[model samples]
Target chain A: MTMSHAIEVHGVSKRYGDGPLVLDGIDFYARSGEFVSFVGPSGCGKSTLFNIVTGLLAPSSGRVLVNGVETTGSPSRSIGYVLQKDLLMPWRTIMRNVILGLEVHRVGRAEARRRASALFDAYHLTGHEDAYPGQLSGGMRQRAALMRTMVTDPDIILMDEAYKALDYPLKIQLESELMDTVKAAGKTVVFVTHDIEEAVTLSDRVYVLKAHPGQLVQEIEIDLGTDSHAINERRLASAFNDYYETIWRSIGAGGRTEVAA
Target chain B: MTAFQIEDAQTGAVRTRPARSRNRHPASRRRTLLVFLQVAIVVAFLAVWQWGATGGWISTFLFSSPEQIISVLAQNITTGELWTDMGVTAQEVLIGFAVGAVGGSALGLLLWYSRFVADLSAPFITAIGSIPVLAVAPMMIIWFGTGLVSKVVIVGFSCVIVSLTNAYRGAQRVDPDLLDLMRSFGSSKTQAFTKAIVPGAMSWVVAGLKLNVGFAIIGAVVGEFISSSAGVGHMIVTGSSSFAMNQVLAGVVVVMAMVLAFGLLIDLLERALFRWER
Candidate 1:
């Protein structure tokens, strides 16, 4: 039998204490090694869905399956999450911050450092091991934050608009690095971003959601002609604009429908 | 030449002045000048004070000239009497500060952990924290006796409140996002407290220590005033009773120096602790 998808979200819905539905009947899945992104306007509960998937917040209804095993309301050790803010502890050095996950997992200090040090060269933070987070630039700090997640070696990664805080150039640079490393490692990624261009360039598939209940409106498979590892080169593809326009129109239509009602 | 010039030299690169300036920065020069002026003003004031007292223009018995104060200080120093007073006072301040600061910080950590304990103690902390050190010093002397123990108790009482308040505030201000991050990693509550709360609260705790320097000294001196034999406060009381204005002024000078020295110590400690911040 074939291996199951990396993760499956069944009819997940959430509401806060008799309040309006925050998320409605969301079904999502990512096959092994697939890159999936959720894009929407603000207040679409993109973050809420992300939290439900991570098991940080349990859905009011429905369950999650990881590798065909039913797991809901309990975070799997196989998943790693990177938030929008780098959240690197300002008092700790870059290396120490990266090893926080390993320390939490109770990995031996020497082995943890050895494993974490190997990724520093790829993350562009080799010389800054002892330097504190305040000394690093925003992009470098974000990279360190990613390293902190990636060093734990989880099979499934969740990034909530991780590059949204960066400027255009730095965002693209980090995105390219993220794609190269994550794809090379064959990890399943579930990303959330509001930037249509970012979603189209980096994701294998995109899920578009509408706000005020945050239901999935559309899912688009992106084909940029060639499966290139470098995300920067994919921007020039003709189909990139097509995918971008489709997602944009889907969200725009949803906005109009809400306004008219 | 223009006041500013950009000349193309090598590789068609425009060079504006040299890369580094050899002259002193304007701010540094201003700082040096200010220090010189300050010293000159103090010297001028002292010269006038000496002239006024010796020439019978002012009452030496009332005001006491700088020279007279200086001579008394010099005499105490040479006879090793000042050292004894300073040593006694320093012990009280240091011991009291260490006890109060450590205990207060631990109490703050406890409050951070248990909301119930924190809420219970909030009003009592405020009530006890505001009670004046002078108002309580006499009671402290009566309770602990007029020995070194009474002075130490007074000093500790004066300092513990600020330390506790600052530490609690610091712990409260630690970013909630960091705690969430820790939770996502499946870290235990103890891990979060030690890793996030303690280090995050350090700067505020250090600030509390700095503020407590004055509080500690004040407590020790006041306790001495109520009843004591060897402290600088005792020296001041004796000098006042005898109408020796020079000795009184000399004691004031000694207290000022002690405060300055302790302040410098805290500065060094702050630098050592927050090297990462720089």
Candidate 2:
């Protein structure tokens, strides 16, 4: 059973004002309910690609389609984004933060409140509805941020290095739980990160992007036998190590050229 | 698992002892007590001043006792002169404050929305703000005559510049990430300004307004002193010219009370407006 494409980007390019191109002629696609990760070194324009796909930035060339609708320069309502920072309003309680998107979209206040309440248990943020974002631990803040994104019920979610700041043990724990939650919710996700292990551990397929004027270099599919949580498998580690070495070699050559400039 | 059990046991013991209050050390309590003691010392000093004046250690001609000032206040109150003068001063102060605040906020928003306007007026605003209100009040009275309008303008002139500068800086200093988030969410330019910029600038705007309260009162009083036939400043001027030290002291006391009351009101407004700042 094949899933339909939820988002499609074709020959997209981006350049800042009077500057060199940051993203050059990239192509990517994600199917419904698929978890895809884009991994590359810093300044590889992974975030730029995420921004372009989410309609935050207008691509210099080419087109993007979300749910078969053109989204090149058009704002998308079906997409939800989680930035690197939690960006939670310090004045708002956890419950209020989660319902912010819905309120902005003009969803009925009562209905938005009800939907947010239902997500509390699933997001592991129960008994924290009254707590302000400042009172939360880093991990808990990220969890609340995730719940905020999910409460809008967007068909596709774009996360830009959302877990980059967490400690290693906490990162692994949250990644597993996030995978479980994503699977249960049955939403398509495009996660951008620079970590090779994180890319292989959570993604159904990983797209490796090249540095400086980022372009799609390779796409590797992971067949982890129906259980994404078994990311600690020995075979998987070896395969990820090989992929990491290849990526590191590519980045090394890219870095030398940058230094020569 | 053993480490977890041990940590849990420690936490349990800590929670059992009303740890929240226990965590507040003696040093913090001493610091709080010290602050109260300092306030008491100030009150005691004021009481000594009253006692020294009444006991004739200080001459009544130079320094009227607190009791003399209180009696004068009571006499003026019974004769209805206090209320009349207070009403006049209150009107000038309030009108000036309102005009200054509204005009300043509007001009500030205009400048914030237009970079070219801000660039054009920055130096001009600085020059005008540099001039003291005392120097301006007499000139304003000469131009507008000894009337309420002159006093209100004097107060407004003193206050508007501070409010404009603070509000403009506040509007300019919004977090870039918050703006980006709003952009990503498809907020229109107007919506973004309304939701993010206005709310973000409110605290600084309130700070500027609070500072301007004292300036407004001073402007009104100075304007009255320069030319007015009425108001608290006129009473002070008359008392000073006649060498009636008690009346002068009484007028000074009334002005001080007005300034303190306005300051308290501003503090209340700050609390009410920026409860989130807590």
Candidate 3:
């Protein structure tokens, strides 16, 4: 783990009420400005870990520190969380929904609109300012969710399966735009997804989790060619196959973790 | 409509036959047929009624032939009695609906925010809501007298109960995820209530009003029936006493028309207010 990381999830574990443990002792960190992903099959506790890190749920054990300061089970402006569901308010217009965070923070409505207006065009949501979430297509709805997250300009962003609902081309386009935006702003991003290729393409370091009482299985550091920015181009690079194969084999081994790889 | 068809990209085989091939002319044709049948049914029913009266197969004194009812309607229209009675009933209903809507929604919000108050009042509210308004109409007349006060009170009472119930249910049904989102943003309880809860309850409020309008009209007529001089209920009661079947049927027809007009107004308001719902 990098020193003075933007997030520190030290030995986190979770079990709801008297239910079986959903996660075992798991620890990870995302350094400042680094893009990290947590990936595994269903029931691997990826979302459970995310909820703890974002302070939405308190871990049964251990604590999370944002920029080295603990904020467990409390709302914090330091983190922005985008859930798998878009969670858009159906009643509000797109502009109003996107500015919800600013409104919650007590920012003036006019000022919030000003800040949000600049992003509409860049996010490909220019003409939909007055439209409701139901009016937008599925991909556009997810993009609006992203815009809602990014507009707050939080110190750390934790996205839980943010693009899984979308189809291929739109997902790829959104992934690139989000990457470019976060990279330019130098914000720490922790993404959770089941798609290994998505993790490999977007993360600087990808941490794989084991299913049922989730634990950290492996951490792979991704190394893209020096100048590659386009995600699809990176996917086509010769080096890409090696990384995919390695991760795939590791996951297969992870299926029977007791056996030697 | 777009489902179950798979032209496999690699093998290029039609794996599953599209069920019923829904995108054909038959669907539109069927709708046209259904509409024509509806019009035909209404016309046939009206013709049968007119034939029964003119052919003397049914007693006009008891059934009040369509022509007699229509003549009564024309007489009332010419004398301006229909408008006067409608105005009186409409005034009572309007005052009642306004009072009930505002008061019930406010009380509901209070109950929503205060857990103890909600728990404390739960049994009493259910008990009160279960009682029929018509049974209490006599008591209302005795207390408020034969003027508009009694009618308005009954209408308002009916409105309050409905609005309160609907608003409360609406608040309870707010999406839990949205609540979490608000909490994650560090929104104050008040902010969450105003921004999320209120808007979420709007559909429920509209639903409550949908019921309230009909109930309020019923309450108004009942109140007027007990002791009012200038309303639809008075006309119906007065016609019944004199055994004027035509007059009674005319009053019933006028009431039906007025209720339909109010219902249309509600529909328009619902469409305008909840335009985003669709």
Best by lDDT: 1
Q: What would the per-residue lDDT of candidate 3 be over residues B1-278, giving only the tens digit for each residue?
A: 23676788999876765466564677797899999999999888867887898999978778777788899888888999988998999999888888886678767866778778888998988888888888888999899888988888898887787789889889888988788888888888899999988988888888888887788888888888889899888888898888888888888887788788888888998899788878
Error of 3 at B66 (Å): 3.4
Off by over 4 Å in 1: A1-4, A17-19, A65-75, A256-261, B1-24
- The per-residue C-alpha lDDT of model 3 at residue A121 equals 90
Better of 1 and 2 by TM-score: 1
The ten-residue window of minimal lDDT in model 1 chain A covers: A252-261
- The candidate, 1 or 3, that scores higher on DockQ is 3
RMSD vs true structure, all candidates: 4.9, 6.9, 7.1
Q: TM-score per model for chain B alone?
A: 0.89, 0.84, 0.85
Q: A1-261, model 3: which lDDT tens digit per residue? A: 746779987888899999988999888888999999987877888888887887878999987889888888876788888877999999889999999999999999999999999999988999999999999998788888888888888989889989887888988988888888889889899999888888888888989887777888889999866445678987887777777777777766667333111
Q: Model 2, residue A198: what's the lDDT?
A: 78
- Encode model 2's per-residue lDDT on B1-278: one tens digit a residue: 32222334644542223345655797988888999999999789769878898688988788877778888889989999999888899999999988896579657855766888898999999999899998878889888878899998998998899988988888888787776666666677766677677777888888888888888888888888898777888888888898878888999999999999988998998887666555
Over 4 Å off in model 3, which ranges? Answer: A1-4, A238-242, A245-261, B1-51, B105-124
lDDT of model 3 at position A113: 96
In model 1, the number of clashes is: 0
In terms of DockQ, which candidate is stronger, 2 or 3?
3
State the DockQ of every prediction: 0.52, 0.31, 0.54
DockQ order of candidates, best first? Answer: 3, 1, 2
